[model samples]
Target: MPHNLTKQPRRRHPQRSQYGLTLVELLVGIAIGLLLIVGATSLFLSNLDASRRLLLEARLNQNLRSAAELITRDLRRASYWDQAVPKMGSVDNNPHQGITLDGTSDISYQFDAPAGAASAAGFALTDDYRIRMTIGQTTQDLTDPAVAKVISFNIIESKNKIDIGMQKIPAATPNTECLTERRYDITIEAEAPSDANVKRRLETAVRVRNDRVGNCS
Candidate 1:
């Protein structure tokens, strides 16, 4: 039995199959990756453009509102008189009651100063399409021309009157008294200088606080 073990044949194990991607499969995977990257980049760029457009629109709106507010505030102070209480019966007593509009682009008015002096002020649209404010000898630009372009500035004036019949006069004579109220409607349209498509329009009404009273002669 020991002599027979000298020539025994050895058993061999089978080789395992190696797994790997083929050339075609590798190229398909690379193409798919590139497509995904391109899609993501496109989406990001779209979102960025939308954000920039929104910001421009917001800025245009803000500029329009600010210009409107300034005009309304200053116009409200028109016809203010420190001695209005004593001169209520006279139509030509208040010197600061001259509010005039030239065509549709220029508006001017007068107001009583803190020291009881009359001050002249006006707002005008320049040839370059910008809003300019003139108060006394000083001139300034209300809106930044680089940021926005003013398209139009329009003003409409309206008046209302109330009649108080048979009022006792200071001299013991009966008189017919009438009260006149004045108001103005302002419209401002503007657009972003960088982007003409971004635009805004604002409309507001301002009523004069100081009423004018006179005998309905």
Candidate 2:
């Protein structure tokens, strides 16, 4: 018996296909990532700028307030005199009872020093748009130019008459002497040197403690 060997064909297994992204899909993904990064960077920059602006505005306000306070405090002490001095009748004939203004931005006044002598003090606006404070021979800037600029400084004086009852010498004449109450209105306007849009204005009224008795004319 001759055995015939029959060769059967080997079974072929189909290979699994590899999956990958197309060129259009890859480009679209990259574009989306870039857009997200750009948006984040822009948001950070905007917030940073806003913070800086707020800080600058606060500094500007502080500077302006300080300058205004200095001016008002000094002006209140314009006619201050020593209480130790002997009273010359009922009239306050103190020579340091007047405030002088140079018709512009300069104002000067005298006050009694600790040693019982008169001292000169003044506040002025310089050409460089800053407030300068002068005490005797010493001078200093009240406001920093880097922080703020003084746009205008003004001091207005007003007077009112009040009756002082009987005169010192009732026998000489029956006329009643009147006293003049002096008051000043101070106004200061300032702005940030770095940004003109940031500005502040302050106004204050001050009354002299010492009254001056005179003709009141």
Candidate 3:
């Protein structure tokens, strides 16, 4: 009993753990953040792709409209006056306008009749009045009737239907150039061989002027 010599052992306080994240926990949080960033980036890229397609379509439409307007304006006035160029293909072998679908199949504009005496077949004058456009590329000509669409052929005389084919029109005959005096309604189709099936169609009308009356004899 040495004055309670067996003093109670000193009471030890419980040690507290450090209140902070471990290295492993930090690495896991970083990984989660990276995943969120990648997800957001993917969404942005997808929207960009869609925007590009829409812009391309709009541009194409704009080009088509402008070109069509210009051509129709000229075509509608093809037979405007007497001082005008001869209404035969020979007089103005040059085409006024061209229609194309994707710039591939080209259809050009020409007065329906043999423009003049010099105009020949395969590019010749025919009694069958027809506004023709060469549909595809030609190694040689602008009026070679190639699967041409007749716009507004007025070859009807007393129940006789005028032929619109290349062989129908006459060369340098009488002054009654019937094709020029005749007004026609025409439609040209352009297609993309790759889904080109009638993708676009340009339509218009024109009357040939300075036409020799009664056509070639």
The TM-score leader among the candidates is 1
Backbone clash count, each prediction separately: 0, 0, 27
lDDT of 2: 0.80
* Candidate lDDT values, in order: 0.83, 0.80, 0.39
Runs of candidate 2 with Cα error greater than 4 angstroms are: 1-20, 83-85, 90-92, 166-176
Cα error, candidate 1, residue 149 (Å): 1.6
For candidate 1, lDDT tens digit of each residue in 1-217? 6877887787888876857888999999999999999999999999998898799888878877888889889888987888888855544456676688899889898888898678899899998989999988999888888777999989898888889664634656566777779998988898888888888888999998877666666
Top model number, lDDT: 1
Give me the displacement of residue 149 in model 2, in angstroms: 1.2
Models sorted by lDDT, best on top: 1, 2, 3
TM-score result, candidate 3: 0.38
Candidate 2 positional error at 173, Å: 7.9
Can you tell me which runs of candidate 3 are displaced by over 4 Å?
1-18, 83-217
Clashing pairs in 1: none
Q: Where is model 1 poorest over a 10-residue stretch in terms of lDDT?
A: 166-175
- Residue 60: error of model 1 in Å? 1.9
lDDT of 3 by residue, 1-217 (tens): 7867878878998887868899999999999999999999898888886675455444433434444454445444332333234554444433422211222222234333334422111121132322232322432322213222222222211112242333223554424333324443444443322232224455555443323223333
TM per model? Answer: 0.80, 0.79, 0.38
Using TM-score as the measure, name the better of candidate 2 and candidate 3: 2
